[model samples]
Target: MSRLRRAAGRIWRVASIPLLAIILAFIVAAVVIVVSSVFTSTGLDVFLPLGAYGSLLAGAFGSGTGISNTLVAAAPLILGGLAVGLGFKAGLFNIGVAGQFLVGAFAAAVVGARLAGAPGVIAAPVALIAGALGGAAFGFIPGFLKARTGAHEVVTTIMLNNAAVLLLTWAVNDLVRAPGFSFPRTGDLGHSALPILLGRNVHLGIPIAVLAVFSVRWLLDRTTNGFEIRTVGQNPNAARYAGMRPIFITTLTMTLSGLLAGVAGAIQMLGVIGFYAPGITASVGFDSIAVALLGRSDPIGILFAAILFGAFRAGAPLMQIETSVPVEIIDIIQALVILFLAADLIVRRVFRVRAAKPVISELATVTRTWAGGAPPGGGA
Candidate 1:
């Protein structure tokens, strides 16, 4: 019983800030709704916020399908959040998940589309590998540059994001365009579709994503390389004194981050789209930054945070149709979550909670990154 209590306390400590942040975000959103109604012809609708939230929650958990939709939407988010979360552990800000996601999905589509009649066992794994390689290759570039040239990852990654979209758009239109389709889309993924789960739209990637969370947790907490990564993130000079190679760890962490994101793209291709198309990412790469911050850069925390974000997405359309509230409200709430996390002191003061900062956080890493020319170990 004592063990159970300790575990519960541990979970609560880790979860308290994010949970409070989410609650505060919704409260603020409610106020926004109440205030906005005053400017409209409807006058002050004090119940507007309650109505909107009702619609959102109902749409997210109202039926079997709603729950399934949440799971399906959450799959890639879990991967994307883990990707960013892992980078935070190593003190690397990987803002190129968008590019990596695109490249991976495209690669998976190319290979999967060619396997016209292959068995699921054979086709699925190969295309997944191609996607992983594609994402890793993109990830490696920035890592290599940052490690060797003292180039900041933020700039290089942002530029690459644009390049990837343009390049993929061209390829989809000209190189791999489906024979019958006039749109900028890739060929059909002939037999590489991931197996559906429980006769629902959910796919193999859902379990894979959950598995990835555990895998990442184990990697960070139960491995020697994990210790080195953490040490480098906390202090590069100290890492050098301990005889660890910061350059290699920097490169490895970024590459691994990309690999996870690439897998996200691959499964999204095989399980969801079955073809690559422009705008397919729908800003998932960007939203994942908020998810990482909400999760405080922990794998387990990322899982819960991703699910919450996914709930918002899965419920947005119905929230719009039912309450006449725009889907953009979801974006505002997400931004608010980030703001609360970045300024956790406000959360602590408001909630009357007392706790020290963790060993690491996405907010800290981001601040250090944007404030400097070169990352610590990578610069030297």
Candidate 2:
């Protein structure tokens, strides 16, 4: 019974902050909606928030199409969230997910375009692997620099993001311009496209993303490598003292993170867009950082958070069309969710929630890295 209580308490601690944060964000968003309505020439619409939220829920889940769209949109977000979440677990913030995602997409596009005449069995997996490898290679740059020169991943990754965009833009326009297209875009993926599972938009990537969630959870909870990564994240000095190589762990974690984000980009291109284009990313890489933070770096938590964000993305258009609530309101709500989570003390105080106590939770571990201004156990 005590063990059950402890386990439940642990789960509550892991979940409460994000849940409360989301609820508070929605409540605040309702007020913003009301205030904005009052400012309009039309008198205040007191029921606007309720109607907007209802429409959003309906657009996300009310019909078969809505469900499919939600899952399809969620697929890449899940992968991207996992990428950022994994980096967080290792006490690293992989801000370069955008670059890694784009580079991966480019690599996959090139490979996928070349394999257009081939069978799906041959082309799909190859494109996926190409994307992962491309992402891994790009990821290695920052990891190597961080490990060797003590440079921060955030700075290095941001610079790489610019470099990647420049390179890919040039490649698309000059080198791979689809045999005479004026716009910068790649050729159709053809057979390399992920098989559709439901309607037009739903595809195999949804299940693949779901599978990745368990794979990542297993790696962190049931593997030796996960233990090493967490140790290095908590204390590079301790890991070094224990004869573990912190440098190597850091590099590996970042590489895997890049791989996931690369897969995200690849799947988005192959599954949804059917080609690589500049505007296809739709801010997924940036949104993933919020997803990871809200999930507290747990793979399972990241999945749920990704889906929630996905629902917002999938439903926002309908919500705007139906209720005239600006789609930016969704962004505001998401930002508020992040803000509340970042200020957990406010949430705890407002909700009358107590700390889980004595036991060191994953949330505490991640926060220690933030508060200390370095990876735990010693400066990175």
Candidate 3:
């Protein structure tokens, strides 16, 4: 039917943007890798026939352990990407996911380590909830400042990140250090701290990540609250005229975004570290921003993007072991992906593609024709 065809076309068009971005990113990364290898080795032949690319692929996906490690690395990325992507949908910039992540990890560590004699089921949920709440509280500060004082979130969030690093250092060094040790970390969590899945460290966090992706997609696409958030992001004044509260929406979205990021922190602790340390989270929060951008702010795209990042993280060890290449190559590839995705205009211009407006207009005409002159907003 014409209606079906129109719907299919719309889906394809919507899907194409991120697809193009990803393809371009990979191509650019490949070019960079090859060129760099050639320059360092004095010939492309040294790098090309060594099976480096094949080994990289195999190290990431050729065995169960490789796949498990990839999924494990990707777990935090999924939640962090959703956090950044959700904030973008609401037209807010959240650069403090790193701080929020730390707070969440600290909260979970404190709770999981101290809660005595509780069953794993109860203790794990309690710790995770505490972690999420802690992250949400930290996230709420920037949102509140932005809503109340016209403060730029970028500045506040970035400042908060520095403060969080110092505070976490203090906590880990002075208060949470193991009873008899000088190490700047809390005591190891008990069995109850882990989220068991398939007898591996994969943990319950993977399912949580999947659920978070689905929940974010639903919140953005199918809910009234989502509509209000999008409306405000697209046009705040128009949203106000339509009775949507931009400030409330902004605060709520940031809070939820923080909550998700916090969940990432908690899961990282529960699934990987088994305790909190000041440096454990590193820059995953910042990396999430790149992941979200590469995903084009779509949840499904984010899932795949996170996996791609995870694959790089997962394969770094093998890449180092087999090829004597520094693990930093993965970082270089990731950086290139982010750079290309951020400069989307360059890709569009280079491709000489028609602008999005004309494509959208053509789709609209097809949809209108398929509806046989029905009311514009009405479903067929």
Candidate 4:
């Protein structure tokens, strides 16, 4: 009985902040909606005055198509969130997910285009692997710099992001442009290279994303490497004292994080876009940071957080079309969610919720360890 009660309490504390933040964001969004309605002279009242929220619901999950779209949108986000979340777990900030994602997509496009005649079993996995490798390769740059020179991953990753955009532009224009096409894009992926899943828009990526959630959970909770990662993240000094190499751990964590981000790009390409094109990614990598933060770097929490963001992305169009409310409202609401989470004290105070004591030993250790300065145990 005591164990059961404690378990429930743990669950509540884990879930309460995000849940309350979301609710508060929505309440504020409703107010924004009302204000926007008042400003618009020519509006349908959405055909019902109280129908803005209803429209959002209908657009996101009112039908099978909506649900599928939401899932599809969520797939890449889940992967990206996992990438960032994994980095957070290791006391590292992998800000290069955007670059990793783009490079991965570019690699997948090249590989998928080349494998136009292969079987799905052969082509799909290879394309995805190519993307992961590309991301890992790019990820290595920052990780190596950090481990060897003590340079900040944040600065390196951000610079790499800008470099990647130029690189992607060059790759598309000079190398992969489809014959006789004016626009910058690779050729269509072979039919077999296309996603095999529920329908045209939806793909196997959803299942893959779902699988990733469990795989990551198991890795973090039940594996030797996971223990090492946690140990290094919690106390690099202790890890060094215990004979663990911080350089290797940091490099590997960034590599794996990039791999996940790369997989996200590949999934989005093969599963949704069916080809590589410039601007295909609409800041999915940046959004993943928010997802990771909202999810608190937990795998399960990331999955749900990704889904919520996906719903917003998937439904924004319909919500705008029906209610005449600008789609930017969704962005506002998302920003509010992040703001509330960042100001947790405000949320707790508003709700009169008691703060939970820290239970995890390694929590927030990442905030201080990135500069590669001496570890807590007095090691370099």
Candidate 5:
């Protein structure tokens, strides 16, 4: 009976996270809509039909186009979320994903535009590789500095973001600008870019995003290297004592994290923008950090969280159109989700009262008996 109780407790704890996250998100969304209505003199009447959620569903899944747009938006988020999630598993804060993403977009744009005669099959792969390389290189710098000179990654990454913005702006404005136009953006990537997937502007990057989520799941859960990374993250000193090199692990993890972030940029450039622009990749990388946090850093959780965020992003415009709600309401709700997720101890306290001490002691006895061991006091 005690053994069964413990098993049930474990299951409940595992199930509570997603349930709480969804509930909190809805509650926050409702509050935002109500506030918006009150301020706009509608007093909840304008937020009708679907109540506060009408715009959300309409923008995300009301039509085939909406659903496709959501998926398209989810692509870069998956990549960026994976980058942050992987960094968390290695105990590294990869706040430089924004910079890495910009570097990737620039690199892919330069490579793809130059390869004029190459087929999509060839050009796409080369551009992605270039983006990945650029992102990896950017990530490696902070890792190197952290390992060798004790420079914190957060500061270095944030500084690098400003530098990346300037550098990309210059590159697009001067080097990669289209001949007939004076726009501060790169030349358009032609047919060698991403293929249209749904006969709409949505591209094949959606499938690639799904595959990346599965790949990241497998890598973290099934691979030996992943085990080492987790160990290092949990306790660097213990990992070092167990004959693992912390420095090497840190460097490798950051590199891979950056590579994934870069892929997001490449997909955005090739599939969405078809060109590299200074502000095109704005805030997506930072938003991915929130996605990773809301998902609890689990790969599958991150995928769902990415979709949720994508839905908000896709639906924001509709929310503004149909109701007086500001598009910034979605941002507020996302921020609230991250805040609540980070404060999970409060949720657990409210919803999961601890089992009494006597109950816990009784459960321990049963567990020991099942394990073929005597109870703590020696009597069976």
Candidate 6:
């Protein structure tokens, strides 16, 4: 009983951080709404917090269509969040997921367009594999540089993102532009390539996303490679001393992470858009970083976080129409969640929670120390 109690306590400690942050964000949003309401002719009682929340709920879950849309938006987030979370566990910050996603989607579009007349099973799987390869190839660059030259992955990955944008623009315009369209986008994917789940709009990607979450959970918690990743993340020096190769692990982890992002792009293209364009993903790659952090780098946690964000996204338009509040407020709410998580000390202090020992992200430390010209003892 005592042991079970301790295990329960540990789970709560891990879970409570994000929960408190989310609660605090909503409370602050309510205060903002109420304060802003005072300026209206209807006076201080015009915009009640509960009313805003009710509209949000109604917009997100009131009908089958709303739920389907939410799931559609969430599917990419699950894979993208996993991409970032996987890097976190491996002691690497893969900030180039956005670039990887773009390249991957482009690759998928090219392959899928060519496979227009193929059978569904062959075309769908091939397109997904092509996307994974494209993303993995792009991810390899930063990892190679970080491992070989001691250059920071942050710097390399950010530069690579800019490069990817240019590459995508050029590729779309000169290489894969649809034969008769005015817009610089790829041709629509064949019907065989698209997977339908609920209706025309919602696709089979949701189940695939859920499967990815479980696969990642198993990879990290029950596999030898996962053990290596966690060991290196915890202490590169210790891993090196224990006969592990840091460079190989770092490169491999980034590649795998990029592979996940690539799969996200493929799913988005095949399941949602049915075509490729520069802005099809909107900000999913960037938003996924927040998702990974808010989920505390856990695969299952990422699934739930992605769904919450998806709910906000799905409901934002209705919330705007019903409450006369700007849809941008949802962005503020998301930002606040990240802000509070980044500064967990503030949450603990505000709630009088015990000071839990911090989980040090070794990548952060390595970045700081390496830039100062003295590589740490562990081969990082």
C-alpha positional error of residue 240 in candidate 4 after TM-score superposition, expressed in Å: 1.7
Per-residue alpha-carbon lDDT of candidate 5 for residues 90-171, written as tens digits (9 for 90 to 100): 7677788999988988888888888646888888878888988999998888777766665667788889889999988887
Off by over 4 Å in 1: 1-12, 39-42, 359-363
Task: List, residue by residue over 1-380, the lDDT tens digit for candidate 3.
Answer: 99999777666555555567656655665666666667665466445424555666778888888899889989899999998888777667777898888888888888888763588888888888988998899888888776666566778888988898899889888787878656667877785476677646678889999999999999988999998876665556677777777778877877888898899988888778887776775478998987887776778878998998888888878876876566777777777776665555575578754435533443343233233332111111
Q: Global CA lDDT of candidate 4, please?
A: 0.81
lDDT against the true structure, each candidate: 0.84, 0.84, 0.75, 0.81, 0.76, 0.81
Tell me the tens digit of each residue's lDDT in model 6 across 1-380: 99999888777777787899999899998888888778876578635777877888888888898898889889889999999888877667778899888888889988998887888889888988999899999888887776777677778888988998888988888888998887888887885365786765788778988999999999989998888887777667888888887888888888888888888888888877778866565388898988898887889999999999999988888887887777888888999999898777677778866533334453354345335432222364
Model 3 CA deviation exceeding 4 Å by range: 1-12, 38-50, 354-380
lDDT of 4 by residue, 1-380 (tens): 99999888888776788889898898888877776666678642433335666777888898888999899889989999999988877787888999999998889988998887888889888998999899889888887777777777889999999999988988888888988677888987885365656655778789998999999999999998787777777778789888887888888888889989998988888877777777776488999988987888889999999999999988888887886777898888889998898777677778876555541332356457555544332334
Ranking by TM-score: 2, 1, 6, 4, 3, 5
Q: Which lDDT value does model 3 have at 251?
A: 79
The model with the greater lDDT, 1 or 3, is: 1
- How do all models score by TM-score? 0.94, 0.94, 0.87, 0.92, 0.87, 0.92
User: Between which residue pairs do clashes occur in model 6?
Assistant: 237-378
Q: Quick one: best lDDT, which candidate?
A: 2
Measure candidate 3: CA RMSD.
7.4
Show pairs that collide, candidate 1: none
Total clashing pairs for each candidate: 0, 3, 0, 0, 0, 1
- Give the per-residue Cα lDDT of candidate 1 at 16: 80
